[model samples]
Target: MIGSKRWCGVAVFLVLLMAGTHVGIGAESLFRHFVKAKGDCLVDGDQPLRFVSFNIPNLLLIEDDMEFVRTNPWRLPVEYEIEDALRAVVQAGGTVARTYTISVAREDDDPGTPKHVLAPGRFNEEAFRAMDLVLAVANRVGVRLLVPLVDNWKWMGGRPQYAAFRGKSPDDFWTDPQLREDFKKTIAFVLNRVNTVTGVRYRDDKAILAWELGNELQQCPREWAEEMASYIKQLDPNHLVAGGVQTHELHDWELESRVIDLVSTHHYEGDPMRMAANIRAAAERARGKKPYYIGEFGFVSAGGIRYVLDRVVRTPNIAGALIWSLRFHNRDGGFYWHSEPAGNRLYRAYHWPGFESGDAYAERAVLGFLRSAAFAIRGLAPPPVEKPDPPHLLPIPDVGHISWRGSVGAYAYVVERAESPQGPWQVVGRWVDDAAVSYASLFSDESAQIGRKYFYRVRALNEAGISAPSNIEGPVTVAELSFVDEFADLQRVFQMGGQVSLGALGARAFKEDLHRLEMSEGAWVRYWVPGEIREVEIRAFGQTDSLSLELAVSADGQEYGPVPVVQRGFRMNGRDYPYRVPVLVSGRIDRPGCHFLQLKAAGALQLGRVEIRYE
Candidate 1:
């Protein structure tokens, strides 16, 4: 019934299409025209659309990149994250952003990982709804989307998953008759999807610029590309189609194919000379044929990136260039971070407006360049950065742990604390970035006396000015803890043995630390402390099953066994454990540890961080 109303609105828009423009009616009102492909340029009415943007890989779906909070590693992005991402693009002056392809579920995905397509011809409603929000917010924020239909890599469950559905080889996905038809079902579903919020079908959503066939497709044949592109055109004539093949070389068939309207390639050359040459070669080839752009590129110095971007601007027929990728703030606190292992482990996902903490990558300078280049590509001057709005402070569980949903473009924030809800307030922290920490508490107020009550609010800051105070969150009680290990350093580990490692199967490069709790009776890590164990707490990822995890303590480092366990929610000091990735356990255990405790897993699990209150 809800979908019926949405379609009826779409029908009304069609009837009034040639009449005039309308606003505040539905999502279609947000975008009055579709981008058109006209001989090497993409146009919205008369003006061509070019962008110096970045791919928002996790915008529609997420591979939870925070190592400290790593769990199933595959979770759906929340509303806060989706909005912040589109806002980041606007802050960078980018008009278009790309997202990772829809994920297909596979048999061996680590226990809790999520996939969009659970079975052939079936979809995960939760995941698709997350996608609906992406389109809705994109329209509301005035940013355009370039969505890929699927992926070639198994990292996010791609070709292999589809082929597996039919009990065939992964390569069969391209040739298998049943598999080809199965994939078309997905294509038709996406193009016809009605935005639950905007009531606009994806095929008609002006927020979307074009639909790419898949993400950097590998081993794809020209015949397959032509067939799929033709199929997509049949389903949605309102949007242009881009060939997502990962290489610089475009096949003659792709360039001449009537249905394939756009051509793109990914680049990662670190040398300026080679990168420039590569861009020229591709642009020259696509010239006079189809609209061409650099779909993805990065992994160089800031200056190197600028040089490549300059090459893109100067090279004829190259419409735009989207840098490697961008990530946004986490709802619970801080930002979701991902390290690019392919970049020799140097680059991580970028945040907007850049912060000092990101100086290592020259994030500030690079983003500054992107903002100017975004307008420069369109032959316009860059505008001044806007003032930041007040950030929304999350409910504080204790003074030791405070976090907030940061304002867009806010590189820092000023945290103010007060004795009463309405009394004199004092600055507790300044120049604080919600992204300084990943998936952890944003700030810790060490000055607050234990057992004292306080109130707190935070204001966002950028060049313009500090924003007004955010909503007050407090009467927060102060708490303390003696020992906590986030698993970043291994020096604290007294003993270790088993199938566990620092990272997991498909997510090793995410952050450099995170202890994967694999299923093994012998898998364990032992730590030594200097006091008797009184109360215990565990922050973990994955379900609590009979074999999930158990804590064992020993007076001597040689012996270990389970202690009486009492599970609790929230932190012992009244701090709330971040529940975004689902903190798995918190328990009170009795032990005579001359201070040594061991964590063991009898089944697959993920341990975020452990807090032990001891004397």
Candidate 2:
């Protein structure tokens, strides 16, 4: 129930981080044995670590900030987020979890940018401290971590970032002598870096399963991998080093390399037959040479995944497998969401226990298969899943604006209301997926009597059943003034014109979330509120930095002109980005009856949410 407690004030960030620090320290006494790579297996003692887990790519720093008009979605997660991620790993019955690439600074980055490696031979203290908590929490939970050193992609600032810093081509990351030595300095910094939370050096931490060179470094030459693997061994003899290339076939030199203890590949081949062939081929290559595993897979059909996992569970040389990715519970509310334009563009990040939005990717069935196969790989039957913990209902001033911190692994939520603090409760709303509203209030009580005082509570639910009721939030009274549309549904009271359409669920482009409306060139959405219009505020995201939106209001839907509105921006990820532009429709001599506020983008913009204050 302590999880339901809330923290407030300007010191909240520091408070949550310090809280995370202590919680991580508590795990120091838990699983501390580093996994070693024996021939064709990774073992803690004599038993190899086999798992059908997931790739929690954002376990350290989250990039999916999709909150309403949030300018930047990049920031370190709080303790609760870490706990939920690792707990999901445990609930899935897995021992080892792999993280995404470690971020590095680039030429374009300023001093304010948050990255693990600031520059060659220079490391960020705060970034590493954030990582220390990640490792600490991993140690506290019964999970081992596989940390990737850097990336080949620009998304996280890796190969090209280093090249830009050194004034060379991106390919120089593999062959150029100066850049190789520079990268070694970065590696040494990480290996020698001590965890501030647990007082354990990176090289000595048992929570780490292996140190991978980089993520999907397919461009890495064979000789460079050998040299770096050996270099890692010299710096950190306590852990194993794995090749981070993205391939279906493991080359002979990789199997024969003396320093490379483990060989792996990422399989996203959607064809079942081809995936099976790749699995068998990779297993044969590492049969008696090195420990082999599926570093990442899935986003394929459920039946296709069944075929692939079946082969993996049966293969002796294939030690384990991890699926593509999952997003955990956010401390503020709901789950953090990410769209993988990479994964058939239909599957976004899967919330644990699954929901209606994930039906397209068979999220429930695939997760069920993962659970059963995870245990089956270890020769055990799947166990029962536990009901979720109580949710944390955030306090609200009005019945129209209601939200709560979601319970991890809970598929849905039910909202209950009572006239008094402790009386008979009434079910106000059922089957609420916090992510379904996507940055909107989780539930709105349109049925609340105007002057009636009310109390609200919520409970999380999934296949295991309903969880205990959340903390009560109360004394909510609807006043005589206000009509707020958080934009959970656009078709309810708005009319669309020109090139405007509801950005459907699973659309990953431009940080698009559920219920968001996308307006292309010359498109407009007219908002009709049945009241005397006093003020209107629109929160939106522009596709381009230069494009602007035109806001106009009319007594009817026809006449329009440039309206007086104030534009605003907020600080995010160390830079100023455009934020909620509160368009103050000033005047008490307002339009009687209904007021129509129409918004149109000259080029393009995505509508996040809207608010209409009227008398």
Candidate 3:
């Protein structure tokens, strides 16, 4: 296989390796390296590796004072809330989990220093003590903790005061024997920190994915990162050493220069596709020594997040990506980050699970599909471009969004929704576009009664037509309903059959009057006709104004009698069948008091229900 021999050489080498014949140094070394860096050949491990870089925002949500979470209703220690988010990732198609934090409340401009802070409780102990709880949760969930090499400190003394103490750059500190000794000791401590929750040791736990040296090394000097990388390799050689590279700092190669285990970076720019290309280019300079990971990529909302994921996952040589963070339910605010619907939304479109509150199930529709595919692709030949789950109806209350899955080529999709599992169903959304499955729409319910259940289903829509419904998905209850009725019925008037209805003598009528629908169902509606009339009447709100047929009749619904004023109209409002226009009559008629007048309807229709009252 060396020196571009031919396909035959690769076949021969594969056969020899299978036979345990011990091939030549050149072939053997290349084979082993490929096998190890890629994955075991026996299994289909060619799928790209998936690593999610999450800035857990752990400490931020902790007590605002950097105390226990209980004191801060808005904050929960990472241990209490991170599992669901990570589990969401696992369900979404992520393979590796990495987390970060601010440690303590400090100035945004403060010089980051690798020092301990004076805080009470276990974290106050330093290293293992400071992040014991975080490390514990990481172990419990079987993931890794990305400990920032700096602490949150005050910036009041200005950048110089703090930088001087913390080492103006990586060079200022690592080049000095005293500081280098301290840096090495810190690395040793970090590598040794164990997770007590799962009984899985730090270096031992397969869960501890990788160690990120610094969140974004460009915050310091590139030379400092070079020193830090060397220190890390010398300290711990087993796990992957990563620098949380930011997109803005892609040019910082100090960490990349050393024999680092993985090339990692973060992107905050809205474009993941462009960012992926940028990150891949930077990672390629590593000479294929290690794979690349997007540790801190995130979107401000669901759409952006999903789009970025699709772009990054499809890119060549990309290991995987992690959203910037997860946090308690809230409106959009805070640092340059993005979260799941279980987290926040920047604008209102359709309803999503994480919109107002968090819904773990909605998240699973996407996450679960991803995890399954990731598992399938590990070490196998890189799969044709894959997709997240298609938008299928779930027996859930609403559609958080819809997506498709497949290699980049022709694809079909279907959408379905229902009040229950075994009953009437409706198709709300569908597409045959070749775009990979991803977030599509927001599903919400306003009329759903609390505690009531609903169902949904999806099937592949192909060249012929719609396919059979996938499966009965259901049991989504209307958790809450905030009906404001701000617009009233002023918008489009909906009728059962898209037509007007008339039934029962004297009791009902159509084409009655002109009046706008208002917030109060009982508000009055008025109209006008040109001409005179001894009597006048109109129908509305499922009922007629009255049966007074005295001296009123007209060929034109707009005109009534000799008196031009008779051609005028009036109106009323009340609960009645919708889409049934009120009927009006005016002008002299031979009959009087309660006489019946018949008016023909143009369409046959049935109103869900009807209401009528005096006009």
lDDT comparing candidate 1 with the true structure: 0.74
Per-residue alpha-carbon lDDT of candidate 3 for residues 457-558, written as tens digits (9 for 90 to 100): 665543334455666665665444321111113232211122232232221122211122211222212222222222332222323323222222334434
Report the Cα RMSD per candidate: 9.4, 7.7, 18.7
Off by over 4 Å in 2: 1-24, 395-398, 418-425, 451-455, 474-477, 480-491, 494-501, 518-535, 539-589, 595-610, 613-615
Q: Could you give me the TM-score of model 3 versus the true structure?
A: 0.43
In candidate 1, position 485 carries an lDDT of 58
Off by over 4 Å in 3: 1-48, 52-55, 59-78, 101-123, 126-148, 151-185, 194-204, 248-256, 283-287, 300-308, 328-353, 356-615
Which candidate's TM-score is highest? 2
lDDT of each: 0.74, 0.74, 0.37
Instruction: List, residue by residue over 1-615, the lDDT tens digit for candidate 2.
Output: 112111111122232223333343544435536788777876666455666788998887787765644545667777778878987877776667888877987655544557777778888788778888888888776678888888998776899888888889999889999899989998998899888888889899888889988888887788999999999999999999988886878887778888888878988787878888988988987887889989988768889988898999888678889888989877767778776766766777777877776787888888888878877776666567668888899987677678898876788899999999896999988997786756556777766766688999999997899999999998787663455654556655577789867665444443445556678878987777666576666666553333367777787677764566665543234322223221222223244554777777877677666767655
> Which of 2 and 3 is the better model by lDDT?
2
Compared with the true structure, the alpha-carbon lDDT of candidate 2 equals 0.74
